[model samples]
Structure formats: structure tokens, C-alpha cells
Target: MKYVLFVYGDEKPWADAGAAEREAVYAQWGAYESLLTEHGARRGGNELAASATATTIRKQDGQVLITDGPFAETVEQISGYMVVEAADQAQAVEFAKAQPGEVFLRAVHDYGLDHLAPAEAPPGVRYTLLVYGPGGQETTPEQAAASAQEHYAYIELLLARGAFLDTVALQGLDTAALVRKPGVEVLITHGPFAETVEHLGGYYEIVAKDLDEAIELAKALPEPVVEVRPVVEYSG
Candidate 1:
């Protein structure tokens, strides 16, 4: 199986750390990347721009409204992602455990574009755009309601274009449980894995002709920090 790892962290800590501390973190990442390569697990990966540069788009009635910042207001944010092939979810979690940040691991499923309408050409492979940002736990009821309405409209647009495969929105990071193994013992921890301003809010898998098309779709999404990754097909 292949898994998409959404990496989240409090960017501030790294940004505010001393030069040596920063270098240490980078070294950790380098080692983790090497591990993936050695295992022939790495497929694709990327680090996103800061949340401050994100643009949130919404189609209301006949107008397309654009917002200047991220959809959710939070401290920790999505900084990067990696796609890797693992034997199963356990191995996937182990891969994430070796990384430097909190990782929301998800299995990838590719639904070919052949079933689309004739106007929508089939793509060579499906792309999984991992949606990462705030969990909206701090938002008021009214604000949450409005955001949901706009998000649904955005989904409708993708569905209409024959690009939608499936989407899953996770609950607040507070509901997360972490599992780990030391030797033969397994350890489980509760609450958000990392204490950051942002959380693994949700994700969407869409079919596209290539990376460019996937990015174009991501750019129009209603969230900040979209990590586009190719879904690896299962040979087993």
C-alpha cells in the first residue's frame, strides 16, 4: 500500500530556534528522507509555502470570492508532505514516527479518469492533494456554518468537472491518538500528536492529467497549504 504523509508543525519553533537547532532538525529530515529512499518507498514529496501566502477561494451565487489568508486561524501549520509505499498501515506509521514533525498518515486510492464524460479527458494517473490547515476548533458556530457552506459549493464544482474521487475531513486534532513501538512493546498516546497552531483538517483525492492540473485544482481550493502528491498503484 501507498500512504500520503501530511506533516504539520509549529513553524514558529523552528523559525525561532538557534542556528544549531535548526540544522539539527534539517539533519533529522535528511536522515528520514534517506531512510525512505533506501527502502524504495519514496514516490513524491514537497514543502509548501507559508500559510500567510495562501489564497482561499469560494464561489458564492454567481461570484467567485477570494480571501487573503488561510481558511482557518491557527498557530501550527502544514509545512511539508511526503508520499511513500509501505507494506501496510503499520509500516506507514513507523515511517512517520521517524520523521521530524506530526504526520497524519492516509492511504491513497486511485480512481482512473476513464469514467469521466467525453469532454473531460482521462488522466495518466490520479493525484492526491492533501488538504492541511486549522481544525476550526476556535471558530464560532456562525463562522463554522458559513465556511461549511462555501466548502460544499467548492466540492460541487469539482464534482461537476469530473475531478472528484472522494474526500474525508478529520475531526479536530484533539481527537487524535498516537501509537508507537519500542522493541516489542507498543505505546499509545492521546490528544493532538503535536502542539501546533494547525491540524490535519482533511484531504481530497482527485483525478488529473498531471501535476500541473492537480496544482491548478489545488490553487482554487478553499484551504491553505495544499500538498499535491501522486498516488502509487498497488501491485499486490
Candidate 2:
């Protein structure tokens, strides 16, 4: 099981500390992460920016309302998350309780509890691939001619095996968002995700045998870091 630790605390103490102290604290955190990786227990973690910059949104009476602030007002507010892969909840709890910082716990909620159904038809899953450094070079006549035949053949192999759900190479981040309110039809503003990362070059979605199988398939895809999570089928 993979568990998430949500950190909550006031930002004042750290801010009150001097720059050297803050750097030292970061160093300590880095050292702790190193220890976890060395012991083969760490998976991933991130230090999020402060909540003052957050924008909260919600749907109110058919209106998509937006607010500028953290989700709530409180002395202790969630700031970041750390994920750890463990054998079970008990083991995960034991590991988290021993962390140097105060942390709250939540299982990486597998929304697919009902998905334990019999594997009749192959599952319909989705994967997102992010590519970068397109090299900006236009295709030459010879290069284009050579790639056409080989690329078509390679694509045929995937289609023949039912492995290609769908694929698209994106232009840039400007195209990531989809318009939620449709303020402007041609200038629609929206995205599949919030915040931003290095590059969301592309994405893919396919069904596999199981979690492990899904990962195995995802790892083979061409993404620097492919996030793998199962889709929870809607039961009606």
C-alpha cells in the first residue's frame, strides 16, 4: 500500500528563523530523505509553495465560484505531502509515526474499490506522457520520407495488438488548459490539471491486467516520469 503524509504547521517559525537556519533545515530534510532512500523506504515527496498564492474554486448553485486564498483559515494547514510504499496500512502507519516532522496520514485512496470485479473485458485505463526538447528542427524531405514507412509500420504493430488507446504530441503548455466557462471560444482557458510542472508533453490511457501490470506497461512508455494511477469505473 502507498500512504500519503499531509504536513500541517505554521509558516511563521521557519520565516522567523534566519536564512542560514532555513538552509540548515532544508539540509536536514535532504539528509533525512537520503536516509530513507538508502534504507529503501522512501518513494517521493515535495515541498509546496506557501498557501498565500493559492486560488480556491468551487461550484455554488450552478455557478463556478472562485476565491483567492487557501481552502480554509487555520493555524495548522496542509502544506505538502510525502508518499511511501509499504506492505500494509499497519506497517505504513508505523513508519509514518516515526517521521521527524509532525504529519497526518491518509492512504493513497484507491477510488477503485468496486473495481475488484471479475476481469471480463480488458480495463479502460489512461496514461499521460510528457515529452520535451522537441529539437525545434523541421523535418527534411529525406528524413520525412524515411520516417513515414517506419513510423507507419511501428504504429500498425501497436494498433494490431490493441495497445494503442490514443496518442497525441502537444505543442506547448498554452494548449494544456480547457475553457471551463468558455469566456472566449477560440481563446478558451482551461487545462486537465492545475498548477504547473516541467513539461506535460503528452498523455495516454489504457487498460491492463492489474496495478503491477499497469505499471509495467506505463514504465515502457516514453515519459521522463509517468504517473500511474488506476481509474475508478463509475457504477450505475
Candidate 3:
């Protein structure tokens, strides 16, 4: 099974940390990444730029409104994510428990697009389009199928433009789990990290020349609200 670990935490402390402190944090992350690799759980992951650099898009009154900042205004923000291959939800939860801050574990919903090439664009910067929507809504099978078709069409457009990297839809919050390690104890909850009406539905990873191009591409997505954030690049 594939699971996504959404790492959420306050960015202020990190932003305020000095170089040494930041490096220490990075070292901790390095250790965690190594642990995942040793366990054969790490598929792929990336740390995102600060939420302040995010650009959001939403359609209102028939006009697409482009705004600054993240989609959610909360104390804790999503800092990064990891896609892990695990045996089951239990193993995924165990993986999440070792992560820093609070992690939302969500099972990946197969949309039958796994065979698509991750990317076709030339080497350049990458961005993640965080898709948010009103959760806990009921939909008939026909309606769900129609919605999937629309997304598939949009994805095809992305592929033709050589912008598609990867995409994943998440199962509903009912199957979601929150893993937190405040101190010595690990706390696990069987729901979303937040109680907001707009829950994170999924995300698209894409490559673009720059932020402007990324925003332009994000405007083409079918999601009601899309938060575009740059991916932090590290030289290997």
C-alpha cells in the first residue's frame, strides 16, 4: 500500500532559527530519510518552500482569483510530504510516528495513471499544486466517474504540455490518521489534523521554468482551490 505523510508544523521557529540550528534540523531530517531508506519505505519526498511564498488560485463569481499565501490559514502549515510504500495502515502509522511534528497519513487512491511518465519537461524548478475541497460530501458512482474523467482530461493537457510530473488523490478523511509525538509519547488519532470544511484532497507535482509559469499551469487544474508551492532543491 502507498501512503502519504503530510508533515505539518509552525514555520516561524524554523524561519527564526540561526544557521547552526537550521543545520541541526536538517541533520535530523537526513537521519529520518536514511531510516526510511533502510526500511524500504521511502519512495519519494520533498520539502516545500515556506507557505509565505505560496500562490493560491480559486474560481469565484466566474472569475479565477489568484491570491498570495497558502490555502489554509492555520497555526500549523504543511512543511513537507513523503510517499511511502508500506505493508498496511499500521506500518504506515508506525512510519508517521517517527516523523517530526504532526503527520497526516492518507492512503493513495489509484486513479489508473501510474503508467504515465513522471515528467517530460527539461530540468528546471518543481512545484506542488495542493488541491483542497469540501470534505465529507456524498457522491453517486456516476458523479464520481464523471469527476474522475474531468481530472483525467486535465491531466492529459498537462502531459501534452510536458509539465506533468506526478499526481495522487487521497482517500477521504474517514480513513485518515494523525500521528503526533509531542514529547516521549506518540499520539495517534483516526481523523484529519484539522476540522476545517476544506480538506486537502490531493496534490500534483509538476516542473516549470519559474513561479509565474507554475501559476499559469495551475490555473488550468479542475480543482476549486489550488495552492502552488515551490519544492526545495538540494544538490546530491
Candidate with top lDDT is 3
lDDT of 1 at 44: 62
lDDT of 2: 0.47
Among all windows of ten consecutive residues in candidate 2, which has the lowest summed lDDT? 179-188
Please write out the lDDT profile of model 3 over residues 141-162, one tens digit for every residue: 9988998988999888888888
Q: Report clash pairs, candidate 1.
A: 75-197, 76-197, 76-198
Give residue 75's lDDT in candidate 3 (0 to 100): 75
Residue by residue across 99-126, what tens digits does model 2's lDDT show? 5455545454333322332235344543
Q: How many backbone clashes does candidate 1 have?
A: 3
The 0-to-1 C-alpha lDDT of every candidate, in the order given, reads: 0.65, 0.47, 0.89
Task: Quote the positional error of residue 82 for candidate 1 in Å.
Answer: 0.8
- Structural RMSD, model 2: 19.9
For model 2 the TM-score comes to 0.46
Candidate scoring better on lDDT of 2 and 3: 3
Worst 10 residues of 1 by lDDT: 110-119
lDDT of 1 by residue, 18-47 (tens): 989978987888898999999999966666
lDDT value, candidate 3, whole model: 0.89
